[model samples]
Target: MATDKPCKNLHRSPSPAQCMDHYGCIYENNHLITLLVDPENGRIADANRAACEFYGYSLRQFRQLLICDLAADPKSGVQEFVEKALPAGDEQSNRMFIDRHVLASGEPIDVEVHTGMMKMLGKNCVYTVIHDISERVSSEQRLRESEERYRDLVELCPEAILVYSGGIILFVNKQTERMFGNKKQELIGKRIEDFFNEVYFQSAEHNKLKTTGLLKERFRIEQRLIRRHDNRIFDLEISGVPVIYEEDKALQLVIRDITESKRELERAIRLQEHRHAVSFPLDSKAVLEKLYIPARTLSGDFFLFHKINEKQVIGIIGDVTGKGITAALNISALRVMFMDSLLSTQNPVQVLNDLNLKALQYLGEDYIAGCCFLFDFGTGLLKAAGAGINEFLYVPRGRDCERITVKGAPLGMFESSEFEEKSIPFESGDRFCFYSDGMELLFNSDELGRDYGYLIERFAGAALQDDCTWLGLNIQ
Candidate 1:
């Protein structure tokens, strides 16, 4: 609403400024949606031809809406300030105030409201000049929603996802926020290179992973991520994949914490090497040796050794379910438990009972297959027990041989799996061979895949614990 101030030309002289209502278009560039709003509720008192055209309605239709309906802000201060200038003298009302006007169809039009003494049929009437701001508002809303959608999805994804282009992180997810120890908003537009160590930035693997994506098969790599606070260091398994983002090609990185697994692997590697080197050669003509090899860095198959007598030994070859770090840890625990038989009980049944007790204590639900053997030199008595383990061969000197039957289920498979040792007379030139299920079968019958039985045949007679253990005893 445009209001008029008191006539300051008190001398009764016909001043030209007071006689003529001085007004023009609010904005020179815009002509549509021009309307004079009533200051109380921002209703259109009058609308120009351009204002009617811009609103997609006639002047009569434009008069039905209020300014508050179109502008996001319901309490528009621009309207209140314009009404305040009406009581002042004409000198104070000479200036203009910019205001936003709401149209009939819920659209806001910006206006520069000029105030002056207006004589319309000899009565004071407020006439407001409006400028259509639809293009500006629509553009701003589109931009805001676009940015918000991306930002929200990034934070919501469970994966440690990040959107990085060139060097900066355009977006980061909630998991990534936790992993990096920073807020997603704080990381936006920040250089990702700063978070990575110099080695990662310098590595060829990083380049290949980022540039070529999964097809390159170089997605996962260990990297160092330093926390800004307290200088804490954490190991991260970083996987970068290439993506098309915002009309530009970019890289999305998923970082996983691999600190615990990495430490365990380093420990297992050293221990496996030590376990292989521990079996040194002796002067005895009759001795048994076993070896094991896993395709991965760790194997489930391992053996426990004990000196049963001055010239004889007792041992058990074990293969726990699975062949990664989890199985390796369980196998290590089993080895420690197997050696405690001397301190606890020498009975094969008791040894197995104690192992189950320990497995129940530490292990979850993983199972194991094992072959337990005890030898006595004084009586030349060789005792062997099978618990889920099969493919055991006893080759004698005169073409007589024996094979072990699968008797018991895998250890840890049941809470009460037991063992019973079977004795055999050991004459000179008798041999006993022990092995894991790898000797049984693994791959499907495809020419390209590994034939597990064929592999066992090729590696059955290998060295003593150099790689994998396949114990062959030439009993004398």
Candidate 2:
């Protein structure tokens, strides 16, 4: 029960002479703990029945105790009140205060004291009313602690977190501070219009109205906003939720930065298109016909055919260990290495050996399966080598295409890796096919599995499923 009300509302005993007139009709009740005290010496003149029961004391014992005796910290609050609560010529006659008080069992509890000046039996005195507020104060303290933890969590979050009401900022996390390059103080009470462009401002307004007006609980969007310091705009993925903050409806927003990822995606698109739109110079005499199909946006299959000199022309086809951008990067590295090696030597074995060493040095765990061919127009002899690749196809002037057996380990695997070289006497009307494993390993149809044996039956024409790169050279 709380009794921190006007003492006049409490029942007063007639024996307390001065209080009898003001509280005579009250006449001893237990609902309120009321007290009459001599203000000059902080002495308790009288206490009602409720006060005696509340303090676990008899009426006479209560009257013997001073007002300061009830306080746990007498010096901090009680002494100050006794000296200044009712100074001379003070028009402010009433005072209310909260303090911790000790009960009869020596246990402390929170209390609110309402005090007012009064004339009791022709002498100045103060009336006191007490209320127990321990439970209420404890609940408030717990709420404060919970709020502190919530604030810490928001401050330490990795993504930007913001709370706003009516498009006005209310709170911003540390990540939001760093992202916008502004302190939380600068953002609080500010509108989104200060940071975002007009387009984003309209979008935010639209989302808020859609969420609050339509009773939507949450919404998400991707947009761009400018940084505060440099005014550089970047992409953001924003997620918003409706919440009550500071007793007012508000919006909670979480922002994720996606500028770098978006840029990388655009760059990859450009690279993939560039790689797909490849153009090879026409070679009317070599009878070169190439076919390339990519399994993805970027192809793991790559082929290169260049005329090294009048006596020799080098052609190669390869498949990197994996697909997509990683394989594409490795293919680029292979092209650079192959071009560098071809500038000095035309031997298929030496060229492959050089590439193998470079692959081992730079390609890490990834490897390349490739076959190299050097055609000598001057001598009508074709030299061939392979590394981690399937057999090459050879067609004589009037003979069926046959697989040429070659031996080599995959590049980037070992330092002592070797490639086998074979020479075939070439005639004027001969054809050779060089292709990646995608051709044989690719699924053609469920009826016929990935068997290169089918290639011998349909050497003239065969369908491919996986990424395939093939280069054909007709001996001129």
In model 2, residue pairs whose N, Cα or C atoms come closer than 3 Å (at least 3 residues apart or on different chains), thus clashing, are: 18-120, 18-121
**Each prediction's whole-model lDDT (CA):** 0.62, 0.74
Where does the lowest 10-residue lDDT sum fall in candidate 1?
A: 442-451
lDDT per residue as tens, model 1, 364-388: 6877678777766677777777777
lDDT score, candidate 1, position 65: 63
Those runs of model 2 whose alpha carbons end farther than 4 Å from true positions after fitting are: 1-27, 76-79, 83-93, 119-123, 204-216, 228-231, 260-476
Q: For model 2, where is the 10-residue window of minimal lDDT?
A: 443-452
Angstrom error at residue 289, model 2: 28
lDDT of 2 by residue, 262-338 (tens): 67545654665566454333354466655555442344677776777666777787878765556667778888988
